[model samples]
Target: MTTPTLPENGEHLLARATAILAKGSQIEIRNLVRSLYPAEAAFVLEALEPEPRASLWRLIPPGVMGEVLIELNVEVATALLAITDRKDLMAATEQMGADGMVDLLHVLPEPLLSQVMESIGVHNRNRFEQALSYREHTAGGLMSQDVLTIRADVTLDVVSRYLRLRGRVPAGTDSLIVVDRKDSFQGVLAISQLLTHDPHTKVSELMDTKSPGISYKTPSRDVAALFERRKLLSVPVLADDGKVLGRITIDDILDVIREEADHSLMSMAGLTEEHDMFAPVVASAKRRALWLGVNLLTAFLAAWVIDLFEDTIQQIVVLAVLMPIVASMGGIAGSQTLTLVVRGLALGQISGGNARGLLFKEISVGLLNGLIWAVVVAAVAGVWFHNPHIGILLGAAMLINLVCAAFSGVAIPVLLQKIGVDPALAGGVLLTTVTDVVGFMTFLGLATLFLL
Candidate 1:
């Protein structure tokens, strides 16, 4: 078992690194991995075959495993789950940070989840279960339960003493969570500052008494947003009883943002995030088909409006050809506004305090944009259709649909947010339906009045 020279590409390097482990040569692999950067090491670890990968479980130490697990995808985590026994799984998950464990656990089945949860110590089990109990998108679910804390009144000597003790500051820990004697959260202390502090000082002597923390029940999505707002490395999580339960770290928030951003992008296009290699091609198609069905249903509403103007469309072939332009423009504009509103909600903006202002802002934007596009497209259509009258009709139709699209786009998400609904879920459907309806009606109705 000797170190192999690095390769050119990530995949080639990853293969060579994984090959060393396959030959049961951990000593050489560990040394080589330690020398390489974390990114390269992560790729190597992720590329390993399941059997060899799990073998690293006993070979590599917790510190290394923690870093590697953070880089692995759900598929690789699933592979790890299949090969490792429950006890080994628990140990490995514990070695990883709390939030990392949650992310991995989310990729497993119910039976495995419960089994792993049960294998940890009672205290660890409690903390893990409590985090698992949180709603998936809230702050509580994504936060870790392993932060260090101290009473505000504690002297600098106590803080210094505790830190010097082995395992008091866990390796790979996010930050120290400061607390009152009653276990109420007080502030956050970074590891750098704690190590640098004088032996005579107390934690209470530190400044910034007002630290940002969340209730244990806050949504994980909200938790991620809080981390972004405060620019914190970690934020302490507390219970209603004021006991400090855990902490949320930037690492967890980064994953949350990535996953949520993916989910939002997919859902807005009416798709879910359940596809995988194990999933059958038919299964993936079916899941996608369900959303396509929703779109089909909504399309009928647009079709019915077109049917209403069947007489006019038949009389003028130009009306039939130009029909798609109005709806397409409105749909695109509406999607722009809808995407902004929905993303704003995910980021914890667009609150009741500013809903009225946001609404006004969207309407103003719509009016300005509608006027600008109406002029541009109208001139183009006038030249294309070779009729000033047709241009007038198209311009008015564009203005009507754009205003409607923008208005409905903002309104739909706000209404959903108001009703304790997720602004991200189903927002696209409602916005599209409204835009389609307006687009069809405005175009054909105006044609019937003026063009006919």
Candidate 2:
């Protein structure tokens, strides 16, 4: 199929492809799929429903299919892989790098995985196995075995000749990894040093030893942070015994950073970054039901708290009307603090050393905000109901709830993290519960003691 004119953007491409597919123009769809880059093709496929996605998947060239699969989210990729022909799967992976192959292996079933593994050459099979040994979210799994290594004792002239003979270096090869004869980590030699330095200079004489190799077991998030802090294009990944394993490039780190950002954003809504937007209705509902149930339970807890003070609410009906305001203000204030602390923890800015200070600061801010809003809310309540006592009780409840919300906001995330729960996923629900219960209890309990 010949390439057609590229669409302006992903939406346009999806629109054009949908129109073509509706017309039953298989050849046109093939050309359309082939015209865009792998990422763009993956985007269009993801945007389509299952039928159209499978249709477009069939049209993708085997050479590009591997890359498109690599670009897809885990759920979508796994679904596509399940129906794919074994021969087609082999063709798709034939030209893939170790890293790309590892990605496919993650979603492939045991039978298909074994077939694919057996199909690759021994050298590549070893590399793929080595990569598979590391957790998908760690440095080793994200690294590529296509690193260029040189002995530290080599001369600049020798390195230059080596590069010329090799014809091409790996993509993102900003520096040559320096290792000893036994492949122990030494340092890195920037490409600039090779071109500008005298030929007589030894690699060790010009190599930078300050930047250390990242351990293969290091978390991908921490690796991304290191890259951001050091402004690195690439870094060496080393085995536990300091043997060179592979190297992770900026592109890999960029993917990690993007996934992390997506994770944080999605988790706030009780979803995963890998969630399929077009998943089956039943599947989608099944995934969301657990969180919805959790939320319902929390809502019941808040309702139970309110039920305890039914008599006070009955005597002062205005308290029922004004109850939501107290809870809402506390929820909003706590959410603000929760967001700040979560971001700080993600960026490694908040730790044991500074967490106490941060907690005190957030509490103080909550107190100050409580005092300010309390007066405003109290004045409004007093005027609205013409009862100063009720107004004062409302204000006191607001202040108490806000303070408790602030404390819960900071403490909940830290505590959840300590127990190995994702704070982002569970923090919001827990915070809402705290604010609601505290706001209701303080407001109605005060009403019962005084106004009744």
The TM-score leader among the candidates is 2
Can you give the TM-score per candidate against the true fold? 0.79, 0.95
lDDT of 1 by residue, 37-147 (tens): 544665555555545555654455545554565565655655555665555555666676656676666666788877777776898777666667777666666666666
Off by over 4 Å in 2: 1-24
Clashing pairs in 2: none
- Cα RMSDs, all models: 5.4, 2.6
Q: Tell me how far the alpha carbon of residue 109 in candidate 1 is from the true structure, in angstroms, after superposition.
A: 2.8
Name the 10 consecutive residues with the lowest summed lDDT in model 2: 5-14
> Candidate 1 clashing pairs?
137-220, 137-221, 138-219, 138-220, 139-218, 139-219, 139-220, 155-202, 156-201, 156-202
